[model samples]
Target chain A: MRVLGVDPGLTRCGIGVVDGQPGRPISLVDVFVVRTPPTDDIGARLLGVERELERMLATHRPDAVAVERVFSQHNVRTVMGTAQAGAVAIVAAARHGIPVALHTPSEVKAAVTGSGRADKDQVGVMVTRLLRLDAMPKPADAADALALAICHLWRGAANARLSAAAAKVPVSRLPKGSAQKGWR
Target chain B: MRVLGVDPGLTRCGIGVVDGQPGRPISLVDVFVVRTPPTDDIGARLLGVERELERMLATHRPDAVAVERVFSQHNVRTVMGTAQAGAVAIVAAARHGIPVALHTPSEVKAAVTGSGRADKDQVGVMVTRLLRLDAMPKPADAADALALAICHLWRGAANARLSAAAAKVPVSRLPKGSAQKGWR
Candidate 1:
């Protein structure tokens, strides 16, 4: 399934679309950032970001959207902006009837790089290699968005399979050791 | 000027509209809360809030919208939801071409009760008194929304006047005492 990922912030919001399914190679469809002017009114700035997100949702038509969840632990001032930006992106996807999945920064890193503590450069390297891009996506936000989409493709697909397997089997009647294999 | 004030939260977002000019009796036009279920997806929750805000804007057609500014210093987890909810309100107002104003909690309290640190009960009592209502508005969020609108009516009007006067005056020509009065 195709997935769209958004790395949201006040100054610049990253949007990326990737097409792939579980156990298959992923390909990049598009990546870009939407930047809002700081001098504009707070409401207008947010409205600008929302408009861009709506446009992206219409243009890409992804099966699902993944957003990087905001944590309030770092950057006290920008935390509010990041949360607000992410909210607009989530709402845009919902309006289009596309399900949205949120992955924390570390979750995205771990899913793509196998390490929750992986730095931005490591995540960027993996995203580039996975997508087979000639160059890494510019402006860390854009690359981060791609990593998020990649994470959703793998994790979402795996979870779906597990659910399907669980639905078909009764725990008591299941064969020995089947549960572990099914969940895996 | 007509103003719609929004007190935004995750579970319930308060929307209140009032009509009045500077130094005049403010009358309530409408008040209500949009409630979103926590069980719903995050995107769906935000979309629910946005849809209600759109309806309010369409119904009231207020000249301006006021939202309580969310701060990160308090309620670490809920702060993100509050910011997201408030962001949607701001974007909705902007979409309707309504100027948006934001007031801090302390600003609202000070405007209504002459004390920045006033408690919720004090703010609610003052809101009821100022609106000349027989009973206070139910739900503390609803009352706070009204207080935000009242704050905008007073502060927004004063700022507008200051801008208009500043535009017409040559600062050098103003008398010493007149300058002080003009600002106040």
Candidate 2:
């Protein structure tokens, strides 16, 4: 599956595209940052980000989009901008009927580096190793975005497998006291 | 000037359109709320709000758009939704080349009810009277939207007048302590 991961921010939104499935090596399709002028009107800045993301969505045509779920940051203004940028990414994916998933910073870190509390350097190193890249993706945002895409690939693939396995099981063969009766 | 005012929210986004200029009677063009199902995906919800806003912008063809500036509310989730909705409205206006202005809640209240601390009821009553409507706009959001529109009309007109007056002033007539020297 192809997944486009976004580290949404008004100043420099990181974009990373990865192709992978569960238990497989992920390949980097594309990586870049979408930046808008800081001096521009807030509306214009958002529009700029949205336009770039829309173009990426059309260009990459990923199966799913993963966005960093913005949490409360030190500065309210900064957090607001982050949240708005993330919202734009989500809407862009929804417009194209592509599924969108949000991963928290910790989740992405844990998924990529096996440590939820991993620092930027660790995450970047792990991403570089996993993608077999000669050099790590520069800028923390870029590495974080790749982590998000990788996280979604593993998590979503696992969930899909679980669902499929459950579907294949016969209801009559279910053990007693199972919650399967609720399915009726 | 024609203005579209939005009181942004996820559950119910209030929209109000008005037409008026400085020192003129403001006329209400339309007022309504755009709602999205709460159970819907966040991306779909934002898209729904954006669609309604775009339609309104096209139909009304407003010269300017006024949106409420969201601040931190009691609920962080609610505030995030409000901010996202507001961002969508701003983007819609920007796409159409319409100038967008943000008015704080207190500013809206003060512009309509002569008191920044006025309650919803006071603002509602003032909006009803100002628009010469028999009934107050239902739901606090609707009234707040109209107040935003009215606030924009008056404040923008005043600012324009100030700019025009400043332009009309000759350099020779400027005071020695005036900041116009820096402006030049």
Candidate 3:
């Protein structure tokens, strides 16, 4: 399965595409960033984000899209930025008909670095190692996007395996609430 | 000057247009809301925002756009929504090459109600009185957008007067560092 991950922002957005197949490790297909000029009208900047996302979808054609869920602290300005980024990602994924999944920053960090408290650099290094990249991703946003994609890949595989196992087992033999209990 | 005000959101965006002329009260040209499907792709939804914004701009030919700045709070999900809405507003204005202005929720409220801490209902009531609307603008988002435009009109005019006054003031009369402190 091909997964496209996004780290959304108003001024700049980071995008990463990863491919995963049965019995093969997830591979980074592409990574890039889209930016909106500060001097441009806000409406135009949103259009730029939309257009860039459309272009990415057409070019990469990933099976799924993964994005970071919003996490806010005390700063209202930062919260606003986080919300704007989340909205853009949601709008982009909804337009394409590709299933979209949201992962928290902590979840992604843990999946990539084996620690939920991992810093951006640590996550970047782990993502580089996991994807076998020659070097770490340049911008921290790109690295976060990659980590989000990796988290999805790992969780998605686990979900698929559990689904398959359930399919083979008789309904009576399965433990109660087993379906609801795993990998949400 | 004609100004378009936007209240952006994932599911619905509120838009209001106002015409501002010298020595006359601001006139409400039009008001409407745009809705997007929740399940649609993110790209398509953003396109929807773009298309709706373009239609508003084409119909009204606004000279400027006014938008609310995002405020972060304790809720991550709410912050995400605000961010998305802000981005959509920014992109819409940018696409048309129209100058854009941002106002905080408190600033807009203060302009309309003389109190930055005023609640939405108070602001709505004040907007109705200020614009002489037949009824309070329906939908909180629509009212908020109208208030944004009103806030811009009030502040923009004040800013212009301040600038003109500063331009005429003699440098010799001003205290050292006073120029930098004036109307920044």
Candidate 4:
């Protein structure tokens, strides 16, 4: 399956496309960053991100989209921007009926470098080696995005299979469980 | 000028539309809430918000859109959802080429009531009186939304004029002054 991964940001959003499935050699199809002028209105900036993402989705036609889930940061302003950018990416994918998965930074790091706390340099190196690229992706954001896609490919494929399996079980045969409770 | 005001939330987003400019008697055009189930996928929930806001924009054809600016809260999860919802509203308005403004919660309360720290009941009472409604709007979210619309009519109109005035002043004609160096 092909996956488009987005590292969402207000000033520079990174996009990467990879073609592969779990336990397979993933090939990098493309990678780019969409930057909006910092001086622009917030609404305009968000719209620019959304439009660029929509364009990428149309062109790449990825089966799924992976986005870096926004986590709380010491800088509230930065976190807010990241969250807004991520939200736009999610909406863009959903509008196109593309399955979207959110991977935490640690999860991406672990999936790529086998270390949850891997630094950017380590993640970049591992991504380069895994994708068999001659050179590492430029701008840490781009590498991070590729890492997200790779993580989703490894994790989301298995997740889909599990979900399908669960769906097959009849309700009467379902195990007793607590009601799902959590904000999306 | 007509304005659509949004009180952004993930589960229950409040929307209100009003028609008037500063110093004029504003009339309520419409008010409602858009809700997404908590159990829905985050991406799908965000898209639902975007679609609902888009529909409201098309129906109201408001000159501008006003959204309650999300503020930092103790609860990170809650704040993230609020910010995401607000981003959707802002993007919807931008897509339609409508000007968008953000008002702080305190600012909305102050505009609708005499005090910035007024309680919800006071804000609701004032909104009912200002809109000349037979009774207060149901659900506090609905009333809060109408209050936002009233606040925008009172504050955003003046702010727009000031912006227009500033834009008209060419840089060469601008008074020699301190460089712009602070948030609005």
The TM-score measured for candidate 4 stands at 0.90
Candidate 4 local lDDT, A1-184, one digit each (tens) = 9999999998889999999967778899999888888778888999999998888888999999999887675577778788888888888898899988888899899999999999999999999999999999988889988999999999877777877887888767866772223336
Q: CA shift at A45, candidate 3, in angstroms?
A: 6.3
The best candidate by lDDT is: 1
Could you report the Cα RMSD, in angstroms, for every candidate shown?
A: 5.8, 5.8, 5.2, 3.5
For model 4, the DockQ equals 0.50
Q: Tell me the TM-score of each prediction against the true structure.
A: 0.90, 0.88, 0.78, 0.90
Instruction: For candidate 1, give the lDDT of residue A14.
Output: 92
Model 3 per-residue lDDT tens digits across residues A26-57: 79999887887766545555677767777888
Better of 1 and 3 by lDDT: 1
lDDT-better candidate, 2 vs 4: 4
Instruction: List model 2 lDDT by residue over B1-184, tens digit each.
Output: 8989999998999999999978889989998888888778788888898888888888889999999887664477787788888888887787788888888889898899899999999999999999999899988888888889999999888778777887789967877765321000
lDDT of 3: 0.76
Worst 10 residues of 4 chain B by lDDT: B175-184
Model 1 regions lying over 4 Å from their true place? A165-184, B164-184
The candidate with the higher TM-score, 3 or 4, is 4
Per-residue accuracy of model 1 over A12-94 as CA lDDT, tens digit each: 99999999977779999999898887767777778888888888888989999999888788777688888888888888888
Give the DockQ-based CAPRI class for model 2: acceptable
Error of 3 at A126 (Å): 2.9
Give the Å shift of residue A63 in candidate 2: 1.1
